[model samples]
Target: MYENYAQRLAVVYEATHKPEDFISADFEFKKMMRAGSCSAEDLRCYGILHHQMACYCIDKAVDLFDKVIGQGKAVDKDVFWRTKHQKMILYSQTGKAQKNIDEALAVINDGSEDAEDWICLIAAYSYSGDAAKAYEWILKAIPKFPDKAALYVYGGDTCRDLKKYDEAFKYWRKALELDDKMYDARYSMGFCYEELEEYGKAYDIWLDIARDLEEDGYEIEKQFPMELAEKCKAVLTDHPA
Candidate 1:
């Protein structure tokens, strides 16, 4: 049953990493679907593989997902939710973020589960530059995962994007409260402070990230800290205390 499927997939193996070969994964997935003996792992694999394809070929990926769903197999619940979320990602990738956000809102309204799903839903709205809707969904999702540092960090970034500096600061501070070692959150706080012209505060926060990165045995240049440190120095130089 899978003979033809496997053969066709082999044709595209060499093209996998080529930037010009868009839909390479989809080409492979088509073979898998044709196998007719898929298992739950196959369904999950199909979901993720198509999702990666959806990043480059939304329509084809969506079709692949539809095919996977039609296979009548029991997909893992997490994979199921992620696949559904990938539908929203497909809309976003196709420049229909608002439409996906509207649909996601409807889905949540109809009682969807999973904090991560809600995170992606809010991200869809945010990607479309709709900060208000993003904020709304994030606000709703936060309570469900109150201690999750990532949620606060995401919320803070959204607020920063909206220029809601105070709100951004509040969220970043909350994230630090939950996990003080989150260097990125500390860096983000610096960004918010910088935007607010609170250079002293920004410098202080950047220094904090720098110190933490050093302690982790990672070079400050290994990530974003070095640039941030330079920025802090520049700010202090221009506005000397």
Candidate 2:
């Protein structure tokens, strides 16, 4: 009862973005927790909710997330590592004065067996300014979770951020092989081609994706990266692919 009502308030708050609604939802969730009415999923939802609140309460939020994790509710879910990831961000934002980034990194290194956990490990390393370790973990994760398209997408994104444009393509290509309909991998690949000044390839990739989205009832102009693609009209004529 408390869980459903609290979630309803959360949903309404999400749609309205009203402070009162947010506060009401938070109050109700706290009430549920105090009453011992929360299930593991409820704890997870409350943890996420607390994270969304302002930074003034972030320490409390992180504690709540830790409690959620302690309940063994993390398998096949991003909440496990994402909590650590968010905690790392908090540490970084405070110049590591409040909490050590190593604390967050340690959690990620240990007890991370799932694919999402591996993804979190990559993010944890990435956020701690260890790009080499992050990239290395990506290599490790891909081999273990060969069919997981999202790992390829994340690996491609990390490589792209490192300015290894060509290497990023290899990841995105593998992602596409795993899931041909992954628009994000395709979009990132288009940008990689553009960065390499392979205009024709960019145009071809974007044009195909734009058409695909249109067929799927999405308005291309309102769909980011789709709109960016249309701006490459001149490339169609100049590169003539």
Candidate 3:
């Protein structure tokens, strides 16, 4: 098990392309377990190693969790939760949407209020078509972590899905207030303005977003606000006054 640890650690640090990392890590993890040279202490070590390996492949992580649990080696509770959480992430990434929702809900049922747990719960709800509950959770999270811009973005998305445009605008603008450099907030506000039929205001805000993105070298001109700004320009051209 220790033999695979070095290679797995290297792949994890190079997080840019993940499929390659997962394959290598999974191979090494399985190789160690199959080699059967592990000591009694190797059980605990394997638990930690498997948990990290799961970051590359959730199925392999699940297998490792089973191995740990079966070993009865008395690993940490945090590691257990982390293993479960990684499995949920894998479920989500692999498009097993309901599985993600169910597993994340299981985490919350365990009475853990850590940021990872709540964020995963929120994501599961959003992905599983429960925008109302997702909004409720974000409301709770906002007071819990007032400085987190993700809560605001999630609130805005939930409100928009529910057709509460004004509330959506309020949340997006709140996100901007919390982090003026929030690129999505600027683009989302431009969208909210468009939905409210405030075309001139929308155009101006989108143009501002385009300029900000350009300054940041973000290639934003091909994305939301910039794209919309280009469309608005086309419309304005046909109706030039």
lDDT of 3 by residue, 1-241 (tens): 3344735444473554455665565566567668875556555554655555555566656688776545442576557655655555566666787887777778788887676667778877876678998888887787887777767877887888889888998888888889997777777777777677666777898888777877888784637677788777776667553
TM-score of decoy 2: 0.56
- Quote each prediction's TM-score: 0.57, 0.56, 0.56
> For each candidate, what is the lDDT?
0.71, 0.74, 0.71
- Model 2: lDDT to the true structure: 0.74
Can you list the residue pairs that collide in candidate 1? Answer: none
lDDT of 2 by residue, 72-162 (tens): 6446355765565566677666566224435535655686567766776676666667667779888888888899898888788889889
What lDDT tens digits, residue by residue, belong to model 1 across residues 15-124?
Answer: 47343443554565665678766666556655765455545555557888777646533656556655766776666767788887777677677787757657777877
lDDT at residue 106 of model 3 (Cα atoms): 89
Stretches of candidate 1 exceeding 4 Å from the true structure: 1-96, 99-110, 220-223
Q: Runs in model 3 with CA error above 4 Å? A: 1-95, 220-224, 237-241
- True lDDT of residue 166, candidate 2: 75
Instruction: Compute the lDDT of residue 116 as modeled in candidate 2.
Output: 68
**Could you list the CA RMSD of all candidates, in the order they appear?**
12.3, 12.5, 13.6
